[model samples]
Target: MTKDQLKLRSLILTALFAAIIGIMAQLFIPLPLVPITGQTLAIGLAATILGSRYGTISVLLYLAIGAAGVPVFAEFSGGVSKLVGPTGGYLIGYIPTVFIMGLYLEKTSFTIKNAMIANTIGMIITLIFGTAWLKIAANLSWTAAFMTGFMPFIIVGLVKAFLASWIGILTRQRLISAKLLFPERLKEKDNKVA
Candidate 1:
């Protein structure tokens, strides 16, 4: 594809992922301090499929939409209040989580193993941000934060991480085959081979 076509494809895919994140955010099992939402799964998929640049852009777009009071957050919450709310850290943390996950895959390989590692790390990063913010925002003690925010989600997060990595790699491979997404590393390898 030409440069303009590629840019348009990126833009469309970015917007689609952003919408996917928002939709996934709505699927939540409500907890006392925080809800376990499918947002993380979508985030993982975005990174694994879109890589660093477009993945991060998709996350930012999702956040911007939520910040604009579009009710795209978990439990149908939104606006700047939600951004600065107790769960705000988790929301904000998606940025680095997606970026690092995508960057990790980009630097290494877009295999299931690498995606698993990246998603696991991304899960930890999100929990750290969420737990820390939950402590301060809710005025809870460290132990309380750890117990409420961090402990409960470990197993669930691990499951989600696995799902993301497995599904993500499969989907990414298909997309690459279909020419919907192209990895820079693959391009470089092609050029070198040529």
Candidate 2:
């Protein structure tokens, strides 16, 4: 394919991944303060596969879609109210997560081990934002916020982080090997015969 065509394809795929993250967010298991879900898994996966810039843009697009009154959020709900509500912190937390995960993935080699570590750190950062925001919004103590918004998600988040990282990195590696992306450096080492 031509270079311009390749860029267009990449843009389309990035947008599709963003939409996927938004859709996956619907699988929410409601909690007291912040509903827990595999949404972060999607975010991590986006970051790993798309790298930092595209991944972050995808998340921003997802947020924009939700903000524009699309019912794409958890429980098929969306509006400005949700964006500014008590759970808003968690929603906003997603932005930084994309940056954190994507930026880390950009700098590091893709591997199961690296993916796990990077995703773990990213998730922790997101949880910190989510829980802290919950604390302030709900007027709860730190302990209370942890119990409601952060504690319940600890085990599951860890598992999802690792799993998502693995899947995303693996898929991206395959895509690079297939020459789906233009720049050869985008591929993982094994795919480059040179």
Best candidate according to lDDT: 1
> What would the TM-scores of all predictions be?
0.94, 0.90
RMSD each, Å:
3.2, 2.7
- Specify the poorest-scoring 10-residue window by lDDT in model 2: 185-194
Per-residue lDDT of model 1, residues 1-194, tens digit only: 79888788878989999999999999999988899999999999999889889999999999999999998999888899998889999999999999999999888778888888999999999999999999999999999999998999999999999899888888877777787876656743221200
Whose TM-score is greatest here? 1
Instruction: Residues 35-152, candidate 2: write the lDDT tens digits.
Output: 7776788888987777777778888888888889998778887887877877777778888887877676557666666678778988888888888888888899999988887888
lDDT of model 2, residue 186 = 53
What RMSD value applies to candidate 1?
3.2
- Show where candidate 2 strays beyond 4 Å: 182-184, 187-194
Segments of candidate 1 deviating more than 4 angstroms: 187-194
